[model samples]
Target: MKFNRTAKAHWKGGGKDGKGSLTTESGVLKESHYAFKTRFEDAVGTNPEELIGAAHAGCFTMQLSFFLVEEGFTAESLDTQARVYFEDGSIPKIELELKGKVPGMDESKFKELATKAKENCPVSKLLNADITLKTTFES
Candidate 1:
């Protein structure tokens, strides 16, 4: 099986003064506005790094859930935060913070599964950056 996702961006003007809109085929982001200020400065709207973080977080969390279910366990809830670092026009690293609870599961096993997810998630494999996973188990 194969799946393809698409997002398009349109820009007007130039550089810091330019304005842009981004849209995805799924329509979740329909003409979402973005600009240099939003990317570099603190302004409203989305940026590439933010979107990457969201994608990583979502993918890792779901992957963990799937692994747990396949192992005859279920997570009560899972939380993940992906922090992307962009430095000197390059993305050097991505850090994933994971927290979740699965009934009747040991912390060691949970951490092991989370590490596996980080290594195997599609986005993690696709990204050209160092990825690190830190997982915490909830009582």
Candidate 2:
């Protein structure tokens, strides 16, 4: 299966004082604002890294749920957080922390499924930075 998603951005002025708005074809981010302050400081808006982290967490959780059901386990709940770190003018690392409850599944199996999701998910595979995962399972 092949899917193509479109997102565009418009910016005015230069760094530290410029403003930008992003939009996606899905309409989930229609004219969302972002800027240097949003990226480097605690400004009132979304940044590219924040968007990426959201995407990663969402993708991984969905993938994990799919695999869990395929393996005959039901996903009671799942929560994931993706933390991105930019250092020295480049994105260096992304860390994923996952907590979940899968009825009738053991910890080892849960970890294996989470690892597989992290390794094979579309966003995780597409990223260029280092990715690490920590997971805790609830029975």
Candidate 3:
């Protein structure tokens, strides 16, 4: 199977002073504002790092859900926070913090599955950075 997705960006002016808008094919981000201040300073706008974080979190969580189902378990809740560390003009690391509640599940199994998900998720595979997973399991 094959699929494709796209996002468009329009920028003008200098790097630090320029302003841009990002539009996604799904329309989830329809011409959303993005700028240097938004990325490096406190501003009311979205940035690429945050977008990557969101994608990583969503992909990892969904992958974990599939693994859980395959293991004959269902999660009552799963919360994931992906922290993308941007330094020296590059993303050096991505930390995925996950908390999950699954009835009749053990910590060992949860950790195993989460690790697998973190390694196998599409977003995880796409990025060239160190990825780490921290999981909290609740039964």
**Candidate 3 lDDT, 31-138, residue by residue in tens:** 999999999999999999999999999999999999999999999999999999999999999999999998999999999999999999999999999999999988
Candidate 2 lDDT by residue in tens digits, 22-119: 99999999999999999999989999999999999999999999999899988899999999998998888999999999888899999999999999
Q: Which ten residues in a row have the lowest lDDT in candidate 1?
A: 130-139
Better of 1 and 2 by TM-score: 1
Span of ten consecutive residues with least summed lDDT in model 2: 84-93
- Give the per-residue Cα lDDT of candidate 2 at 130: 94
| C-alpha local distance difference test of each model | 0.93, 0.94, 0.96
Report the alpha-carbon TM-score of model 3 versus the true structure. Answer: 0.98
All candidates: TM-score = 0.97, 0.96, 0.98
Residue-level lDDT of model 1, residues 1-139, one tens digit each, is: 7989899999999988999999999999999999999999999999999999999999989988999998899999899999999999999999999989899999998998999999888899889999998888996
Choose the strongest candidate by TM-score.
Answer: 3
Q: After superposition, how far is residue 84 of candidate 3 from its true place, in Å?
A: 0.5
